[model samples]
Target: MISQNTIDTVFETARVEEVIGDFVNLKRAGSNFKGLSPFSDERSPSFMVSPVKGIWKDFSTGKGGNSVKFLMEHSQFTYPEAIRYLARKYNIEIEETEQTDAEKAITDVRESMYLVSEFAKKYFHNVLLNTDEGQAIGYSYFKERGFTNETIKKFELGYSPETWDALTKEALGQGYKLEFLQSTGLTIPKEDRPFDRFKGRVMFPIQSMSGRVLGFGGRILTNDKKAAKYLNSPESELYHKSKVLYGIFQAKQSIAKQDNCFLVEGYTDVIQFNQAGIENVVASSGTALTPDQIRLVNRLTKNITVLFDGDAAGLRASIRGIDLILEEGMNVRVCTFPDGDDPDSFARKTPYEDLVKYLEENAKDFIQFKASLLMDEAKNDPIKKADLIRDMVTSISKIPDRIQREIYVQECARIMDISEQVLVSTLAQLIQKDIAEAGKKQKQEQKPFEVHRNQKPKYTGYSGGDPEDPRNGPPEDYPGEPGYPEQQQVEKIDILYHLERKVIEILLLYGDKTEVFEDVFLRNNGEGEIETVTEKKEYKVFQRIYLSLQEDEVELSNTLFRDIFTGLIAFYHQNEKFSLEQYLMRLQPEFAQEVTDILMEDEKVTLHDWEGQNIFSKGKSESISQYVTETIMSMRWFLVDKIIEELKSSIVSNPKEDNMELLMMVMDYSKLINSFSRKLGRVMSRYHT
Candidate 1:
């Protein structure tokens, strides 16, 4: 467990804007910062970060929370992983206590495999840097390839020794379990005999977006005719080749800053670009481009420029990747080098400025590049030219945006000297075919519903343990009750649910501030007569809200609202000076999400911009006391009205002779409702007593 002092220090020292700025490009918007949503692709900025509140809200996707939650959602880091990342960013020393036996035993499988992979990465890096053979072979090879000592260390390049059992034995000797080693594909375990998987090879560590080592890709130094030149770690718990992109950990910040990514084919291309002082490059690591890999880069930026080798023959093989990028709604441009140069060789030999200028000047949109490349093959041959036009139309049809697709068709028609109508018709046919194919596939995959009479329905959130047990049916939910509205949403414009959410919003925003409140309530005067008593008192805003609700026997009807309500109350009760940032950081992700949604409600409204138009709007904080009083009184009246209607229903159902008591009860509640209306400054009153 991390010590409380360390967590507290980290929470205090880490600024939300500074932490999120590493992954996102934020521009000042009034008191907040706004940027394109990382969770979605959009031209407009919908993601807002409020440094004052220490929270971020992505209006596009509705994912809002503190800094730690952003890391978790963006990079898929676990809670502990997110915390450690923040600690590293803020330079706070993490003090973790020794784990008990039970704690160690319960660690997750993927996390265990990550530990083994990390240890292997360190062990191999040590061998490369410290061992005599490694310095002569692995280190020398990197240097020969024009990699600096700094670059080698930045990428954590390493070497595994030639001995078959070297790593396995060292790991076992160091008290690292063999199971995790085998699971991570670092060692091949056979009949209690294990050997290093990447033995005698130069190692390249593949890391996640959060910088955790997931696996390794190694290349053999010597020519062993029977062996593969480059061998990657096998699929395991923590590594998925199709979903992982090399150098994303190092390139994410640069990619976001540049608003573009340079797509490459291998690990060296990524490292060489970085070494050339050109960051914002990631590679697919020899695997064909996958949608998941594109989506990974999509989270950072919506523009990708693919750098291909000089050979024209290889260009055709990459066309599928271009279409995939287009299908993901990204703008993909292609840039190739001169006859004999690739990104690695060009960057290694040319100056940084020239290389950058070349890319900028030569990078053409995918459509233009394809049409130019294929025009040479189809020159003056009418039959081949028709095929080329069709091919261009097919590529254009993959684009998701209608305007871009239509614009490309026009460009294709102009480049091919074909009729615009012909190109548009071909593009339409290809697109219709794609839609038909997709619909057919969906139908094939959607198997007919199976009725398994003996199978019970699954309830993921059910606390009733056994589904097979007859007593464990569904949750005990009451939709008709006042305190539970989720089963039946009561958030209509005329309903009281909106008032419940308003109370929660106020508490979250201004709960710690002291306020004076006056209230009128009925009490027996000790003479068999009821008298209204007026009392004025000073209390914290949260205390006033809580006491008022408790007196009326009312609770927030929404589950999420109720959680935030109780959680905020407990947080305020414990701390003297409330820290909204610190409290938000401590909340569970779901609770924190609801809290930000409530607090940022006003920021999302158009009225917040009235000041910019020279038409100023009233600020809610200026009249918070009156606002709280009116909201609470209105809520009480709404609930009492429901009770009066219930009493009326009783009188109508049972002949009026049996409902005299109910009539008197309605009259008493009616008087309270009229009083509440008067307190709210409303002229018209109902059910006058």
Candidate 2:
């Protein structure tokens, strides 16, 4: 078990911005930081980090938390694992208590796989450096490719012996479970015996963004006609090739610092570039570019420059991937080496400055690059030229930004010597077709989630036995009845949901602030005249809100809002000042995330400026009192409306001789609702029928 003292030290020392900034490209926004969401594919900057509060919130996914929580959510690490990761990043010395069975079990199957992979990486590195076979074969091959000892060691490059079962024996003898080895794809299991999966191959360890070993990519030395040249670790709990980018662990900081990423095709390309003094580079590891991988880099930077070798055929084959980057709403440029070199060989031959200069000078925007490379092929053939123009239009259509699309269309028209109008028209058609197809796909996907009641509601006679009573018969279209639309019910629930959440948001943001409140009462001591007296009193914002809620006996209907409300009330009474980090530490991950969403909702307003709009920035310290009162009155109004609804429902379900009692109660609620609307600065007709 991790000692509580060590956990405390980690929590206090680990800065949320520093820890999260390693993986995300965070820029200063007012007092906080903002960046593109690491969790979603969004072009806008919606992810925010508050350094003072030591918390980060992703508005796109609605996930927010502290340093450890960010690691757990972003990397999918368990609680203890996330704590340990933060501990390592900050160099905090961990103090562990006595070993317990429960603590051992916390390193789950996924972690076991990670542990096994880490062990394999170190063991293979050891073999490559120390063993005779590895030295003469694997070490020699890497050295021949111009990999220095420092580069090899930094990347944890390793080698597996030619002999079968060599790694398996060592791993088993060390008490690492064979099941985990097999699961991580380090050892291929057989009924007869297990053997090393990368035997006689040089190893390349694939790491996640936090520098944890997720998998490996091995390159075989000998050109065995039957065997594949490259073999990657299969999908496992800890390793997902599509979502993991090679060398991201080492390149993330440099990528964020440079605000651009160099995407190559192989592991060697990344290593050689790093060795050549370029650190912001990663490889797709010989797989097709995926949206997940693109998003991985999208978090760190918005620009990706694809590097290709001199092989024209190979470069042409990779041109399609440029569209993938564009589809992710990223700026893509292309760079290619001379006829004799790839990134590895070119960097090896050139000096550092020259290498950097060449890359900068040669990188061309996507439209220019695609046109120049493909124009040669369509050379003077009228049929081929027309097809080439159509292809450019199609590629332009994939870009999500309309302004960018227009710019690229103009670029394409100028380069291809075609009319801009023709290209724009073609692009429009392609986009329309895509929209139509997407609409059809959405309809197909929504069908399963549509209302699925298997039977009709049973109709019963009203208490007065009136057959014509509306409550006794189903309407032409009502919720839960066949053919009834689901949208009305959804809208009704959403109204109350927003109202409840607004209360919780107010309490969280302004509860600790002290404000003056006003009270009015009739002053009469059997004097000549009974006059109204106004009294002013100072109370903490929470006290005023609580008193108002207590007066009505209002309880939040949503489970999350109720928890937040109760917790906030208890916390405010117990402590003088509210500490978001301290309060969040005491809640579960789900509750903590929701509470963070409420607290950080105000931060969203500052990231964007509104010159003439007064819709947001309502919870600033200067305006806390009025904002609190207005929010409370709004909730009271909603609750009064609900009470009226319930009373009306009660009257409809049962017939009364006079109905005077319910009618009077509804009338009182109506008057209260009008009063609330007046105080809230809204007309009565706006909130009341």
Candidate 3:
């Protein structure tokens, strides 16, 4: 177990913005920062981080919590692991009591996988740097490709030795299980033997977006004509090639800062570009570009510059990727190397400024590039020329943004010697075809359900029934009444709204208020009523809340009440004058959720965001606080009134007023109602100004 002292230190030192910034490209959005959610594939910025409140919320996923929670959710780290991550990031030393062997044996599977992968990375890196065979093969290969020592180490390039059981044996000797090694694909198991998977090949570690090693890509050096040129780790619990973009872990920050990503085809291309000072570059690792990969880059920047080799096959194979990028609503530009060179060779030959200038001058939009590449083949061949035109139009039609598609269509027409009107008409037909396909797909998705034979059409909760008719659920009794759905709903809404307003009021108005409630005497009890205050229902609620607040407890059991309650807890802890405007500025999503929950529950709420004139008035801190107190007191009085009414009905039914217990209950109910009414009046008068 982690000590309380460690948890507190982690919370105090780990800033939400600092922790999240490592993975996300956050841009200032008003007082908070907003970015694409790392938790989901989104094009727009819906992930919000508030440093003041020390919490983050992904509006798309509805996941919001403090820094520790974000790390746990994003990295799949356990609580202790999250704490350790923050401790390492902030340079805090952790001191823990020794654990027993039995305790150490109980490791989480996810963490175990991470540990095995990390161990493999270190072992491979050690082989490349320190072993003679590794230096002669792996190090020499990287050096021959013009990579400097610093660049090699920065990328953690390595070699796996050519021994059958070298790694498995070493790992087992070091207390790691062979099962975990095989699970991570670090070791290949034969019928009765096991061997290192990447033996005799140079290594490239593939990392997660958060920079943890997940798998590897290995390149074989021998000229065995039948041997494959490159090999990659199989899909494991930690690595999915379809979702992983090589070098993203290193390039994400630069991509965000520059607001662009440079896409290349291979590992060397990524390294060479970075070495040439173009830091925001990643490789697709020879796989066809996927929507998942594009969305990953899209999270950092909307602009992508695809760097391709000058070879014809490479260009033809990559054309499909351009449409995919466009479909994702990304702005893509294509740049090819010289006929004899690729990104790796060209980056080494040209100066950084000259290379950047070359890309800027040569990069063409996808539509124009496709047209220019295919135009020569179609020249003077009417059928082929018409096909080329249709192809360009089809590509243009894939763009999701209408204005962008129109602009591309205009450019395509000019390049292909076709009329803009003709291109536009063709695009319209393609769009209609797409819509029809989509509708057909929707119908196919709905085919599994059995149609109801004699169903009465459902009425939504908004359809208010006749109030005078018992047939429509007993006249829809108001809140605090017996046997009414609306009454329970109203009670819930009143409690939430009032509690929030009271907390906010305490935070904004009386943050520094030191007024204490004095002990009051009770004539019937002889002793002062204050001594028995601990047992009173209202006082018990206050006491529970007060102790929780003092313990730095912030999370409210009710999701609807959490944000306001948390804000109140923070306010008490800060010891500074609180500002409602600033608080709202920071936690807009939480506040919005709370407001929506309240409004959606009750058919009639006492206070809206505005007053009777539809003007913004009651939402002010003072007005809201007064309204909350009124609502709570009114609810209490209403409950007492219902009790009194029930007792009177019982007495009338009996005809003889001889029930002493019933008489006491009625008196108590009346006294409570009168007290609550007086308190409600005083609270209203307090806000009458």
Clashing pairs in 2: none
Candidate 2 Cα lDDT to native: 0.81
lDDT of 2 by residue, 295-322 (tens): 9998877899999999998777788888
Query: What C-alpha lDDT does candidate 1 achieve relative to the native structure?
Result: 0.81
TM-scores for every candidate against the unseen true structure: 0.65, 0.65, 0.60
The stretch of ten residues in a row with the least summed lDDT in candidate 3 is 600-609
**lDDT of model 2, residue 302:** 88
- Whole-structure CA lDDT of model 3: 0.71
Off by over 4 Å in 1: 1-65, 70-80, 84-108, 189-193, 440-507, 511-583, 586-619, 625-689
The candidate with the higher lDDT, 2 or 3, is: 2
State the lDDT at 361 in candidate 3: 97
lDDT per residue for candidate 1 within 178-254, as digits (tens), equals 89999889998888678889999999999998899989999998989999999999998789999999999989867
10 residues in a row with least lDDT, candidate 2: 459-468
